[model samples]
Structures are given as structure tokens and as C-alpha cells.
Target: MRTVREANRWAAVTGALLLVALASSGCVALLVGGAAAAGAGTVAYVRGELQSTLDAPFDRAWTATVRALGDLGMPVTAQEKDGLSGRITARAAGDRKVTVQLRKVSGTATEVRIRVGTWGDEGASRQILEQIQHRL
Candidate 1:
């Protein structure tokens, strides 16, 4: 019984320290779950990026993202794409860097991630995502 108590205490301390380390490293996560079931999307914000699973194919999603950037008047600095993944780098107003990454999740789903600036601007990221979704 004493040994068991000691092990439990050590585990609790280790878990708390891990959480503290992650928090101090500027790693934060917010999960907005259950949207997929409602035919919308599943979204998460983590580590200065907004991630979402869109109900669209990778090709369609990639096209929508490119068009969205153009529609928003953010000049595309760079774009790279293959069959499985794609990335778009753009310059927002004031030259703030924006990045959009996409991966093929399934035949009917694509994963999208967006980050604005260095640390991240959640509002701006969300707006970009909304624009992409609008095109999709």
C-alpha cells in the first residue's frame, strides 16, 4: 500500500510539471468538437494555428484556398502542392505573413491549418478560414 501511494504521488507531480512546461512554451489548444456530426466542420486552435477538417476533397479545398487568398487581396508569395498535401504562403496587409496548409484526410474530407504572423492571430486566421470555406 505504501509503494502504491508513492507511485501515485510521483505520477501526479510529473503530470503537473508537464502541463506547466507546455503552458510556458506558448502551447495552447482549444477544441470545438461535434461540428462534423452537424455537417459543418471540426475545428481546433492549437499552438498558434487554427485547424479544421473541411467536408471537401483535397483538390477542391486547395482551389478554394487559393481563390480565397486572391479574394481577400493577400498576395500569394509562394504555393506548393502535390497529390497529398498543399501549402500557401501569402502576405496580408502590412506584410504580415499568412500560411495555409492542407492535407488529404479522406475522399470527402480535407484537413486545413492556418496561421497568421509569427505567434498567430486567431481572428485573422479564422477570417481566412471563413473565406476558404465560403469558396468551398
Candidate 2:
């Protein structure tokens, strides 16, 4: 009887230790996951592709995108639009290419993505996106 009691107590202690180990590992996983997400956002910001969702219809957003390009003096080299989506490609001085993509998210919402140059110029892309938002 005494030995059985000792064995039961040992088993309970071992189970508790296992649970604690699992809980601590979960915390580590959460920290790593959060760091990964932050790193991805930083990389995107550094890459110079600016994205925004605007409260505007697709046609209106498309028009604003074109106007923004022109306002920045980036001549539109190519453009196409349909009921659901549109894209405008342009070139600025120094042959920097700019692309603006507009996607209809809903009847009154659009997602705009802008990238400047092949390697992406953060300042230029941000300026263009802000211009489009202002026009919208």
C-alpha cells in the first residue's frame, strides 16, 4: 500500500511537469510567430510597394489612378480596365517604371497596389499612392 501511494504521487508530478513544458513551448511558438509577422511587414515596407484599400468604386478609383500618374508627370505607357479590375503602367524620369493596380473589393471599395521601378523606390511609390488617395 505504501509503495502504491508513492508511485501515484510520482505519476501526478510527472504529468504536471509535462503540462508545464507544453505551456512554455506554446509561449515560445507564439513569440516566434509574432516576430515572423513583424519581419514580413518590415520587408514589405523596405521593398517600397505601397498598398491601400480605398472607399471608392472601381471606375472612380481607376480614374483617380490615371490622374495621379499624370499629376506626378509619369506618362501612362499602358492601361486597361474592366468591370472588376484595372491596371496602369507608366514611366517616370530616369526610366523608372510605375505600375498601379486597382481591384474591386466590393461595390464601393477598391484595393490599390503601386510599385515604382523594377527594384521598387519606396519614396516614389509612397508619393504616388498618396496622390491617388488624395485624388480619390
Candidate 3:
């Protein structure tokens, strides 16, 4: 039989390998970053957008997003909200188009996706997400 120490070592190695695999696959990013609070969820910068799921209601998330834009000096160009989803379009520095979309996942969870410009701005997107998380 394997000793307790040997079993623990094996488990650690397995966990490390799993993490490495996930990281290389771009899945680990989804499980990392952000604060330890309830709504301090992880964020991922994929394609041309930054995405995150906050443990807050849709209304709250929407409000925080708007506030975040204001805090970042982004001017709102258009906005719409409904029972299940919301979208806010803004203009950032250099007149870059910034879009934030929110979808209701549950009563206490909402998914937020942000895109800056036609392509993407990872730094600006991250700042917006951080601001939203702060407000949440």
C-alpha cells in the first residue's frame, strides 16, 4: 500500500499537471484573478472582448457597469435594458467604441462582456471589469 506521504505527493503532482494542461488550453484563465468576495469573480480576455460572471443580480451588474464607464471617462452613446439582458455602448479615448453586454444568468448571477473598439483593448477592458467588480 502507498504511504500517506506518497499519496499526497502523487495528488499534488496530478493537480499541478492538470493546472498546466488547463492553462495551456486557455481554460485556466476563466478560474483565476479578481478578489475573494462573492461577486469578485474571475475574468477572461478572449478574442476581442473581456468576459466575466458576477455573483450579483442583473440590475446591480448593469448599474455597476454604467458607473464603471463613467468612472473611466467613457461617454455613453447608447444603452438599453430589459428583463433578461442589457447593452451599453460608449465611446472611449480616441473615440474608440466600447460596448458592454450583460445577460441574466440567475437571480444572483450575471454575465458581463466588454469590447473596446472593432478589435479589442485588453488593458481598457480589464480596467472596466475591475471597476465593475469594485462596485459589486
Q: Which residue pairs clash within candidate 2? A: none
Task: TM-score each candidate.
Answer: 0.72, 0.66, 0.71
Number of the predicted model whose TM-score against the real structure is largest: 1
The lDDT values for all models are 0.88, 0.79, 0.88
Which candidate model has the greater TM-score, 2 or 3?
Answer: 3
Backbone collision tally, model 1: 0
Let me know the TM-score candidate 3 reaches against the reference structure.
0.71
What shift in Å separates residue 10 of candidate 3 from its native position after superposition?
23
Candidate 1 residue 71 Cα shift, in angstroms, is 0.9
lDDT of 2: 0.79
lDDT of 1 at 129: 93
lDDT tens digits by residue: candidate 1, 1-136: 9999999999999999988876777553311144343343877788999989899999999999999999999999999999999999999998999999999988898899999999999999999999999999
